[model samples]
Structures are given as structure tokens and as C-alpha cells.
Target: MTIRVADELLMFLPAARRGPVSRVPSDGTSTLGHLVESLGVPLPEAGPMTLGGEPADPSTRPDPGAEVRVASVPRPQPVPLEPGQVAPRFVLDVHLGTLARRMRLLGLDTAYHNDMDDPALVVQANEERRVLLTQDRGLLRRRALWFGAYVRGSRPDDQLRDVLDRFAPVLRPWTRCTACNGELVPVDKQEIERDLEAGTRRSYDVYGRCADCGQVYWRGAHGGHLEKIVHEATRQVEAAGVAK
Candidate 1:
């Protein structure tokens, strides 16, 4: 079978296989998604596919001589949801702690643990019905995972952008605990005065505390930097006409 890939996906292919089209001796048994993964492009990073010029799903099996075309996942790609969810929630791998915090800052429900093993992570993803976010292609290839996506870029900021651009989840900034993925609720300053340092107590009046973790938040010196991230993401989603 001949597989044609779009230009955006060229970077994931091996140098010898890097071309507009690749001829693969198909097994005629494996699904198109598996074939694409075998070619080094993770399934989540891939976009829509066409088989013989007809739209096809990843599970479609191709004949040995059929032509297949693949494209990169488009910006503002809708997040896949499980039952009972209004929006996509995420479970991030250990290495993505910073990205997790950033996502939580945007009030996205992000679950993360620094020491969770692959098996554990998969279990959490399945159990919680969260979209697994990871930099590991191997992890993304796991069959048992309910849903997942490959996180592009190295730096946390760039990775955040990649995710935001790929799946424009509704943003509710400052409504979640960056430290613990808990819902943030308004807390009277008097109720948490003992937890704050003297300077913090004097400088900030409005506050929100995590309902689950009890961590407090206020607009402090770093607020501007965080606000910039929020504004940029909001603008991008608005520009793409994604729902708030």
C-alpha cells in the first residue's frame, strides 16, 4: 500500500521514509492507525485520513495496494470526551509537571503525580476518563489507554501552546488550584490570615483557596506573567472560534 503524508508530519518520519509518499508492504491485517504509528507518527498527533479519497477512521484496515493519505492534527482540534464530561480533563505524565501546573492555571482539570509508573498512569487515565498527555511516543502507543495525545515542544511554555492550539478546551482561568487541580473558591481574607505571611496578609485582600488542598491564591507579583499566558491562550481560542 502507498501512504501519503502531509508536510507537517514530515518531521516524525525517518529520513529514508521522509517523502510525499511511502510504499509499505502491508500486512493487510493491521489497522491504519497501527501502520501510521509504525511509521513513527503517534496516533494522537495524526489528523484525519483518507483511503482511496474517502474519509477513513484509524481502525480501517487497508488492502495491500490501496492508497492512504494522512494529515497533521488540526489546530483547535476538539477534545475527545468520555461519558459525563462537559469538557476534556487530563492526566499528565511525570515529566510534564510544569505543563500540568500551567494547564491547571487555566482552570483545566489536570491530574498529575510525579512518581506514577506507566501502568499506574494508564490506570488513572482509564479510571478517570482523562486524556493522557505525554512526551513519550511509547506511552501514547499503549492500546489500553482510553485517550491520549503527544505533547510537542520541550519548554513548558511552548508545550502549553502546543496543547492549547491542538485542543482548545474551555478556559476558566484562576478558578483552579495550580498546585492541586482543586476547585478554587473565594475565601475571606480573615478566614486564612494565619496561613499567610505578614506582608502577604497586608498586601492582598481578595483571595481564593483550593477546596480540596487549601492552598491559597492571590494576584501577586507573578500575576502579570501568568495573565499573559491566559490572555494569549484566550485570544487564540477566540480567533479560532472555539467555545469559551
Candidate 2:
């Protein structure tokens, strides 16, 4: 009923050390996944598992005094698809509001709201088949979540880069509203003439309108700033992902 987590995984433990942990039942039977979870390290934190040095999955049940080991994973594994389940999407926690906007800017369908509570966030992630993205380790441990990732970066650019490298979601820039997560559709400049500010009208011609929020978008001087961010983020993620 004892378990030894990998050194890399020790961060997930309160003690942060490899050791014998868990309370064994009188019958001496405890599943590896359950034992790992009992130690405050979620199953997702363990990469490869083994019983007596042989390869095993999370479901393997070990007898008392059986040696169980867990390794660290680069990222959480995708949840196995179930019948009637929708395609997986990304769900950002409240703290990642800026990263949410960045992901939306890249045309990824990201779901986020700064005011959402933990319970509601978990529900949305589970019910919608979304991959919960957060820096909170406890939130990522929620058993209800089918797929989740721990954000390792502090800044928006670093976080966005980590996400892009992890899930490798399709990147389609300028198709979503940065202010609101709405799809941007092409609009004739004349169609939104009245909506445009005087400066915008005089400086830009092409336009896009949010189908949901009715916000107008045009490539203005600020477009260069956005392009630089996107270009830098893409380069960082891609460069880091290349095998050395």
C-alpha cells in the first residue's frame, strides 16, 4: 500500500520527496491511481507507472508492500473519446484572462470569464469536453476533469507559448474578436462607416465585424503591434518544440 512518486512529481506532494505513502486496506489491496491521488498528486501528474518495475497504467492495483512508482509527464494525456462526447476545447481559469485573449486572438475557440468560480469552471470544462488550463494544481486534480494542463509560465506571452507547444491547436489569426470571444467576419468598409471612429475611417479601409458582439475590427497602426506579438509567440513555441 506504499507508493513512491518520481522526483519530478514531488512538487505535487506536500512533502516534496519520494517515500512510502498511503494507508493500505486490511486486505492489502489499493489501486495505483487511488494511492497516487491519496498523496495529493493527481493521476495526471504521474507519467509512466510501474508495479515491481514492470510497466503499468493508472488502474493497476498493488498489494501491500508492493513497490509502485510514478513518473512525470510532459503534459496531461488527452482523455479517451467517449460515445457522444464533443471535440475537446480549451478552458482558461480566471487568472489566465490575458492568455485567453491571446488564444482568442490566434483564432482558437477559448472559453474564459474572470468571474467564474472554481465549481462552475470545473463543470464547464467537464460538460463541454474542454481542456482545463490553469496554474492552480488543485483545480487540475479535479477528478471530474477529463483533460487538463498546468500553466507553467507567469506572463501572457510565455503562457501562450506553453499552450501552443502543448496542445498544438490549429492557429488561425485575426478571426476572433480580442475584446470578446466572437468570430470575426469580413465587412465592407462602407457597411460600418458610421460605426468607425474618425481616425479609423481616415486611416484604414478593410474591416471585420464580430458576428456575436457587433464589434468592428480593422487593420490599423495597432495591427503591427499585434502581428509582432503573434510572430514572437509562434517563433518561441516552434523554436522550443524543435528537437535539439
Candidate 3:
């Protein structure tokens, strides 16, 4: 029996499943879908599979000289934010440290650590029901992962845009601790006045305290900068919708 597999699909499959040329399969019979999945590529990774130009389910068996075509997965469609839909949360790999920070600044629930091992990151993502965001292909290959995305861009800004576009989660500004990803609670100006700098005390009145880390936040120079970035990102998202 001879079976044909696409080059991209070959990279994720086990060595035993591939052949020296375009067609290989000396013995045994298996469904094309099962064989592709056995190689570590998820069904979603290979959008639709066809056997001999006919739409075939992954469960369909392959015969000798079967021409199997596995198409690459399409980019995720942007889902409109619904009033009751919960915001998407993320657990980023160590390589995406900057992206995690940006997400936090935007009040997105993002978990990150510069020193966490791969296994620990995966565990945290699963335990917290947070989407796994990574540049590593191996981590995305994990079967236990339910919601994961491969960051296609290299720069932090580009990566952030990629995430926002891909998931289309609701945006809530100034609600999270940028350093620790904890919820921010409103605090009276008098309560945190002593902790503020002399200049900050004279200029800013509004403040929020991080429930977990106890860090104080106010609309200082840094806060203004962060707000500007958030505003710009929001505008871009809105403009994209209008253009469509």
C-alpha cells in the first residue's frame, strides 16, 4: 500500500509513517486522519483532509495508492465580543515575556514568568483554564491543551496584535496589576497618599490598589503612556471593524 502525505504534515508525523519518496506504506492499513493525528498534528492543524479529491473524514480508511491531501489550517476568524462572554485569559511561555507584560498593562489576565520550565507552564495553563500562547511548536503540539495559539510574529507589538485579532476577547482597561496580573481594587486617595511620591501626591488623585501584591496605581506619567498605547490598540481594532 502506498500513501501520499503533504510535506508540512510530514514534519509533525512519526518517522515510521513517512516514506523515502512521495508515496510509501509497505504494510498495514490505517485511516488518513488517524495517521496524521498519530504524527502529533491535531485535526485543526490540518484543516480539511481529502482522499483522492473527495472529502473524507479522518476516520475514513486509506487504500493502496491513496492520494491524501491535508490542507493547512486557516487563521482564526475574529469572533464578535458578546456582553456575557468571559474575557480570554492567557498563559505565556518564557519566550513571550514582553507580550505578557503588554497584556497585563491592558488589564488582560496574563500569567507569565521568565524562569518557568515548559512542563510547569503547561500545568499552569491547564489548571487555570488559560490559553497557552507560545512560539515553541512542541508546546502547541500537546494534546492536553484545549486552547493554544502559535505566535506567528517575532516582535512584541506584532505578537500582541496577532493575539487580539485571533481571540477577539473583550478588553477591560486599568483592571489588572501589570506586575503580578492581580485584580486591582479601587482605593481612596487618602488611604494611599502616604505611599505616593511628593510629585505624584500633588498631581494625581485617582488610585487603585492591587489586591494580591498591594501595589498602588495612579494616573501618573507612566500610567498616561500605558493608557495611550491601550487607546491606540483599541482604535486599531475598531478601525479594522469599520473597514470591513
Candidate 4:
């Protein structure tokens, strides 16, 4: 049998097959879904398929000499989230601490606790309906997980870009606490006055606090730095064509 992949979905195809449609040895009876996974693309990542130019589901077995075409998941994907997750919320395993922090910087609802075990992470994902974001393919292979993605990049920047490209979560800057996965709300100066140092009290009037942790925040000297990152992340997500 022969295989062809859409340009956007090519990355999921095997390396040599990634550049163009290529011929493949086929089992006379295996389902198209099995063939897709055998070639390295996960079932969830696989989209519509066609055999011999006719519409087909991933479950359909191809006929002999059938030229199959595979497409990527349709964007904006259907991912679960917490009630207010304008973009999908996330649950990261221990390895993604840096990425989690970076996501929180963009005001995304990302849950990352270094102490969580694999079982706990899976349970949390199911209970909270948050997408599991991990580099481990084994975890992504779990059938109980309703939503997830395999992070292919080793660097934090590339990981972030991959996430932005794949999920297209809406950017909500300064709306979440980077220290904790908590929502941020404006707090009047006098309300959190007891928590502030004299320098903080005198230097900044605008204040915000984490609804869950009660951690205080203000637009202090680092505001510009935070703004810069927010702008950069927003630009990247936009360039990825997923920003709403």
C-alpha cells in the first residue's frame, strides 16, 4: 500500500516518510488505525483518512493498492478544561516544572506538583478534566487519558512553542499566579497592606493576590520584564495561527 500525509501532519509520520508520500508494506487485514500507530502517529493524533480517494475512518481496513492519506487532528482541537479555561488547562508531570511555570506566566491554568506520582497524575487529569502534558510516551499511551500530547522538544522554549502550535490555548497574561496555579484578582492597596513591606507599600499602589494561596503581587520593578515575556508568548501563539 502507499501512504500520503498532509503537510501539517508530516511531523508525526516516520522520518523518511515525513517529506512525502511513500509506499509501505501492508498486512492484508490490519485496520487503518493500526497502520497509523505502527507508523508512529498516535491514534488521537490521527485525523481523517482516505483509501483510494474515498472517505474512511481510521478503523477501516484498506483494500489492496489503496493509496491512503492521513491528516492531523483538526484545530482548534476538542480538549477538556476547567470551567473558565478559555484555553485548555494542563497537568504536567514532574519533568515539566519549568514548562508549567512558563505556562503560568502566560496566565494559563497549569497544575504542576513535583510530588505527584504517575497514578496520581492520571487520576487528577481524569477528575479535573485537564489535559495531561508530558514528555513520556507511555503516559500518553494510557487509554484512560481523554486528552494529552507528547511534548517532543527538549528545551523549554521549544516545548512552549510546540504546545502553542498543537493546542492553541488562549493567552491570558497576568491573570494567574506564577508561584501557584491560582487565579489572580485585583486587591485594593489597603486590603493587603499588612502583608506588604514599607517599600512595597510606598512604591506600588496596584496589587493582586492569588485566590488560593493568598500570595501578594504588585507591578514592581519587574513589571516590564513580565510584560516582555507576555508579549513574546502572545506573538508566538499568534504566529502559530492558533491564537483567538
Best by lDDT: 1
Q: Once model 1 is optimally superposed onto the true structure by TM-score, how far is the C-alpha of residue 184 displaced, in angstroms?
A: 1.1
What TM-score does candidate 4 reach? 0.80
Against the hidden true structure, what lDDT does model 2 obtain? 0.76
What is the overall TM-score of model 1 with all chains considered together?
0.91
- Give one digit per residue, the lDDT tens place, for model 3 in 96-137: 988888888777889999999888888898787788888877
**Candidate 3 TM-score versus the reference:** 0.75
Report the number of backbone clashes for model 1.
Answer: 0
Positional deviation of 131 in candidate 2, in angstroms?
0.6
Tell me the lDDT of model 2 at 90: 78
Error of 3 at 212 (Å): 1.4
lDDT of 1 by residue, 38-109 (tens): 888888778999999999999999999999999988777776676776668999999999999999998899
Supply candidate 4's per-residue lDDT for 180. 89
Which model, 2 or 3, shows the larger lDDT? 2
Please, what are the lDDT tens digits per residue for candidate 4 over residues 38-104?
7766766677888888889877888668899988777656676556557887899999998998899
Total clashing residue pairs per candidate? 0, 0, 1, 0
Worst 10 residues of 2 by lDDT: 18-27
